[model samples]
Target: MTYTHILTRPVRFFGFAALAALLAAIIFAGAAFGTTVFAAPIERTDVLIGFKNIPGFAEHTLVRAHGGAVTKSFHLVPAVAASLPSAAIRALERNPLVSVVEIDGEFTAIGHSVELDNTWGVAHVGAGSVHHDSVVGTGIKVAIIDTGIDYTHSDLGANYAGGHDFVNGDNDPMDDNGHGTHVAGTAAALLNGAGVVGAAPEARLYGLKVLNASGSGSFSDVIAALQWAVDNGVSVTNNSYGSSRDPGTLVQAAFDNSAAAGVLHIAAAGNEGNCPGNRNTVGYPARYASVVAVAATDKNDKRPCFSSTGPDVELSAPGVSITSTYLGGSYATGSGTSMASPHVAGVAALVMAAGEQSASAVRQILRDTAKPLGDSNHYGHGLIQAVAAVAAVGDSSPPPDDSEPEPEPEPAPEEPTDEPDTTTAVVSDISYSTSGGRTNDRHLTVAITISNGDGAPIGGATVSIDLHRNGSRIASGTGTTNSSGVVSFTLKNAQTGCYSTTVTDVVAEGAQWDGFTPSNEFCK
Candidate 1:
């Protein structure tokens, strides 16, 4: 069962009514301010503007005065979505009623996965244990700002709360494509026992249709969704979508407003994989300080090749081969950081349901309890741990004071030694020793041996190791077991310091065997 996502390929939308009113502004904005629109056929320049404590009518008139027209108005967020000629942006910004203006950009939905077999993601993060305590994200409204949700699906309908459709301008936010439905399932699919279970199965779900059928949407629609999440007292908003470029000032401000309103906006770190430059390529709104950027990891706590890494990433989750709810009341699997983000969102809902309603507090709890992997840019603080987050839940009045001691790391799952048939698949022994101590000649050897109950060596087993120095992985390697079931990985040019190694055993037919990360400090 694979989970995680990215739905690339944005389709152009050109409904006659939405087009005719905005073409002039598109041309004007494009020509005047160096803004470019990838809009096909009808090039309309759309933008979201936050008003500066001004009357609604005055803000409306201001847009018209600059050759623009009001297409939509938000409920509580002092903002209006409109299309204006390029020349009008400066004037609108100059108006006392307008506080910020930004070009509406495009966005793509996403997914990430390692296997499509068993949906172990929910259990991997310890949601299984939290569920037994009856803290299943009940009453917490989590808005999935993706394509849309298939409320008709039996597992999701009861928890489905009505939402706005920023795409075609109607109340029905049903998902035309399957991306949003998948995201919804990951975050809050019903615990019906028949299909896959979600992280927060009982959490109220709202489908904010920002991305279109082609899995792409504009920045204005996203802002509208964000505004709705803020106005409605939504506990959390899961944004499993992103764009390469930063969204304009209006959207950024909207994110800030959402955070202030206690709406935890969780977003994908993007699937660009450091792009062509191997850079820190986290995208907006994940890159924004107000949003919790999420990175993707497989069940073994390994970062996928496509998961983007950067300073903006706040946490990681199981994204590879993650299986969850899908269109037509079915389940499907896919891969991308898009899938990883919703896991955190679901965990946030769980934290909120546990009585911590403050967004900052929830974020801090998540960070404090997360299982640290290594390297902030790659894995952030490490994979999100659901059990620890729920366990660390405290008063919602304010975040735990910095002076307070941080929570301890959650323990890994116990490795099963014998099968039902009494056949033992021993996880032999993982011994870490260092050799070659000279500067620039330091070497670290990680030996992993596997055997059966008969004490016979099991060959063909895969041993993947992560060498950690000061609790951070500084080097890693992969090796295969020999005929005697022993695999050794020697790190060349190893750092001259005490280091620990995490080894995993993939017993060919046993990819599920996530070797224990038994740490032993050995000096070079």
Candidate 2:
């Protein structure tokens, strides 16, 4: 969902209590000495700081010396969430150890109230048949990163493993707001024969409360929650909250790192749809390349006015008036891309439980088996079909074979020569270089090298690159590699900001292109 505008009000430093106590002591001492002492209030801003290297005690001490307090420190992403004086931000950005400094933007739950109704999404997405086949997402961990989950709810308690409350900084992640509970129910509610069941009724649920009762929270909290998910061995994360604004390199880095660690992230595309559906309205971290952006559809498989459409949207699911478990052991119906995301997540769990555990493999299986609807903008690969996806991995039971005539076995084909055909080619390295300082005069060049498995250069390979700045693809180019196995693409008049180049494809006549490890490079 599109977040409300970020909160810009000045905040007091995290050490304000200690500072006040010191001020009181100074005032008493000054009065005894027949003098008055005063301390100016420090106006701080919540920010996420990215480090060139993983931060340690020295870096934290530096922040404290500059009147900043570390709220959270991350291990995998090399970043820290802290509150610093507005004037100190520039100093930190200029620090040799710091890579980027950005204000922590706000994100919120995307769903709105709707009339109570039956849970039609499970059957609509073919989960009912899959459930009947006895593959109900058993032994899979799906983390719900939102307001929180009402684990005490009868339908969800059985699946609730445990959770952390980032908003309240505690272990109890109870949902004062109903959004997370409803979302959790749709993803992994229990099949206890009373209330509505989830798409993957047996998947374990972990509640990570990033947002508060008002359904809004800062980017720092979301990042910390994601880090927690990655650290705790979560298989998949259902992020039904987002902001239209780009959350800068720190958030993207967290998602990419988590994805690299085998955590599949699914998020809402947004509620900013249009009648024509021509605009790209997907929100971050959904817009990030590491996440699967989900679009919302109705019972008739029609895109709703509020469901955002974009190239980033990878899958669509039922979101309109879907009822699920709510706070206080109740149920509620809501509508938004938020409702659509958990459907995909639950199906993802089902596929994972059905013997496809790799995050990338599950993503491709879901895409390959989705029911296609016209217009990729409105419906990316159409609706997700749980049975087809599960069956694709050979997990579902086939129908019993009836009486049939025996047939002769076909002859086997001849074996090929031991050594022939193409050699395997892979991207050896990708590097970035920049020139010029003025806004309109800046230029960026990306060089990619391809080589074989033995590290020999693969010449004449066609390489394609997508140039991204600030998380959006701005330009793309294709060129053949030189005899030295290097292909360089330059963007003239590139704006000064975070830049990255991804090798979309590599082709050669006598060499098969094996996938390479992907990484990002920045010019700023």
- Across 1-524, the per-residue lDDT of candidate 2 in tens digits comes to 11011101122354888869856754664454322222343677988888887766566656756767566667667887777889899999899989899998899888676787777998899998988877788768899999999999999998888888887665678999989999999999987888898999988788999999999998988888887787677889999998989989888988999999999999999998887898999988899999999999999999998889889999999999998999888888889899999999999988887777799999999999999987888899989999899888754565412111112321111211122223756678888776667543476777888887677877877665567789876765656677888877666556778877766456665564532335657766
Predictions in order: lDDT: 0.72, 0.79
TM-score list, all predictions? 0.65, 0.70
lDDT digits (tens) for residues 72-134 of candidate 1: 555445676666777668877887767788776788886444346778888899887888877
TM-score, structure 2 vs. true: 0.70
Worst 10 residues of 1 by lDDT: 1-10
Relative to the true structure, candidate 1 reaches a TM of 0.65
Shift in Å, residue 102, candidate 1: 2.2
Give residue 306's lDDT in candidate 2 (0 to 100): 87
Q: What is the lDDT, from 0 to 100, of the residue 3 in candidate 1?
A: 12
Off by over 4 Å in 1: 1-44, 75-78, 90-100, 111-115, 274-278, 395-524
What ranges in model 2 sit over 4 Å off?
1-38, 394-524
